[model samples]
Target: MRVLVQRVTSARVTVAGEVVGEITPATQGLLALVGVTHDDDPAKAQRLAEKLWQLRILDGEKSASDIGAPILVVSQFTLYGNTTKGRRPTWNAAAPGAVAEPLVDAFADALRALGAHVQTGAFGADMAVALVNDGPVTVQLEL
Candidate 1:
């Protein structure tokens, strides 16, 4: 599993001109672009969610949990895209939808279990994501 974590001031995901998920945090928050691979399971999702909530990237090096920050989780199989061979990218490292969707849900659920406010985009929708990245801080984690 992998996640692209971005600290943001506000963010939202829209589908077909309709807002699907949104968050305008009172304090700094995170946007987690989660991807799943063939070997990933629910356990990995849980661990990563906990790690994301505790990650110290917000103001004063505080964690999302520390500041009661919300997290917007989006399914992003492209995180595993590979382009080492040719101009076109390959999806060989990404898990098939059947294997990925549930894990994405598990990731959000884990965040909720950790007392983090979790918002999310539709699993397989064509979404327009908007965000104001705070400090322009972004981090990537793979596990």
Candidate 2:
């Protein structure tokens, strides 16, 4: 499991010109782009979700666990994209939708279990995401 965590002042997702999810301007919060690989396990997805919830990237060095900040989770299989071969990126490392959708949902559920206010983009849908990246702080997480 992998997650690209970005600290954002605010974030929103739109699908077909309709807003699907959003986060208010919080003092500290995360925009998490989550990905699942073919070998990824449900337990790893759960652990990664929990880790993101508690990740310390906020101002004052407070973790998300300390602040109860909201999270915007998006399914981003592209995190696993491989460009080593040629001009085209190969997505063979990414799990197929049938296997990935459930893990993505499970990851979100795990975040919810941590008491986070989690917003999500539709799986397999074309989405436009907007955000005011706070501190331009971004981290790539794997579990």
- Candidate with top TM-score is 1
Against the true structure, candidate 2 has what lDDT? 0.90
* Candidate 2 colliding pairs: none
Local error of candidate 2 at residue 30 (angstroms): 0.4
Worst 10 residues of 2 by lDDT: 20-29
lDDT of 1 by residue, 75-106 (tens): 99999999999899999999999999999999
Best by lDDT: 1
Off by over 4 Å in 2: none
For every model shown, the clashing-pair count is: 0, 0
Q: In model 2, state the lDDT of residue 107.
A: 92
Per-model TM-score, in order, reads: 0.97, 0.96
